[model samples]
Target: MLNAVEFQAKIQNGLIQIPDEYKQEFGEGDDIKVIVLVQKKSFPKKDIIDELTENPVQVNSVLSREEIYSR
Candidate 1:
């Protein structure tokens, strides 16, 4: 198990989303992550640039995080 992680993203479908800033920073199929953690695990997530790529200049991205599961 791990703790909280912040990621830049935009809102869509009432769900947390990924940012499109990775296109230049990362690339196609890059294991891009904004935070560093000790415990790593697989996650079912939307592609970072899938939605924003259409119009990179239109959408505003924000940093989000994964709250630590302290149970």
Candidate 2:
């Protein structure tokens, strides 16, 4: 039977150290497959808004509440 484990870890000096919690699952000489996935950086809301809208819409000056509210 094959066992699988998943955990988040940071790489240092090009090495990924497995956590101590999973150490007992593997034997000293056992062969294992490894996969590395680099996490992407998240953008701040202000930065995203700036990127999305270089020229924002001018609404209040063009149309007042009276005009919009009239039915």
Give each prediction's root-mean-square deviation over alpha carbons. Answer: 25.4, 7.6
Instruction: Give model 1 RMSD, 1 decimal.
Output: 25.4
Candidate 2 wrongly placed segments (more than 4 Å):
42-71
lDDT of 2 by residue, 1-71 (tens): 77889999988998888899999998999999887777878764577678559867666566678978995
List TM-score per model, in order.
0.22, 0.54
Candidate 2: what lDDT?
0.83
Which pairs of residues collide in model 2? none
User: Of the candidates shown, which would achieve the greatest TM-score relative to the real structure?
Assistant: 2
Candidate 1 per-residue lDDT over residues 1-71, each given as its tens digit = 33334565544786555455534555478664444333435655657686567656653664355433432
